[model samples]
Target: MATMKDVAQLAGVSTATVSRALMNPEKVSSSTRKRVEDAVLEAGYSPNSLARNLRRMNLKPL
Candidate 1:
């Protein structure tokens, strides 16, 4: 599976940027979003929803 790091690297951005792009695309600038979208496609990245929610909730996986 492709990791967030892979997508971030491909997008030439920090992991936080990748997170924001994936979760709240409307917040990022159009240029940033375009780069992120292209990188995501090239990198074959897919966010793990459980992990995302877990991070947001500040909880560990069981």
Candidate 2:
């Protein structure tokens, strides 16, 4: 399985940038977003849906 570090290296960005691009593309510049997106597509990287859902839940206050 491809990891975030791989994506970061391929994208020429940091892992945090990769995470932000995946989770919140709007937060990154368009060019950077494109690079990240392209890297993700080329690498066939998919975010962990369960972890993503957990993060979504955490973002919402009880």
Candidate 3:
């Protein structure tokens, strides 16, 4: 499985950059976002949907 570190190394950027690109693409430059996106596609990376959903749920108050 490709981790964020793997994507970062493949994209020649930091892990923080990969995270930013995935979570908030607009925060990153277009070229950097493209590099990160290409690396993710080439690596067949899939974000953890379950974890993401859980985080969203946690953000909402009961």
Candidate 4:
């Protein structure tokens, strides 16, 4: 039962960095991307698509 926080902690970065690294790799550095990827594999992380879609659905257009 690994969480996003766990992945962030393992990667030595913030949760936002983990999200960016996962959702938008171009936004993160190569070294940070590698670290996040390694942490994801080590933590057996899996992004929850449904939750992400739901979150986007709830966002109001600016």
Each prediction's RMSD over C-alphas, in Å, is 1.7, 5.0, 4.6, 4.4
Prediction-by-prediction clash tally: 0, 0, 0, 0
Q: CA lDDT, every prediction?
A: 0.90, 0.89, 0.90, 0.90
Q: Deviation in angstroms for 47 in model 2?
A: 1.7
Clashing pairs in 3: none
What is the C-alpha lDDT profile of model 4 across 1-62, one tens digit per residue? 67788999999999999999988999999999999999999999887777668778996434
List the candidate 4 regions with Cα displacement exceeding 4 Å.
59-62
The candidate with the higher TM-score, 2 or 4, is 4
User: Which residue window of length 10 is worst by lDDT in model 3?
Assistant: 53-62
Give the per-residue lDDT of model 2 (tens digit) for 6-43: 99999999999999998898999999999999999898
The segments of candidate 1 whose C-alpha lies over 4 angstroms from its true place after superposition are 60-62
Per-candidate TM equals: 0.78, 0.74, 0.75, 0.79
The digit string of per-residue lDDT tens for model 1 on 1-62 reads 88989988998999899889888999899899899899999988888889989989999999
The 10-residue segment with the lowest total lDDT in model 1: 43-52
Candidate 1 residue 21 Cα shift, in angstroms, is: 1.1
The model with the greatest TM-score is 4
* TM-score of model number 2: 0.74
Model 4 accuracy (lDDT, Cα): 0.90
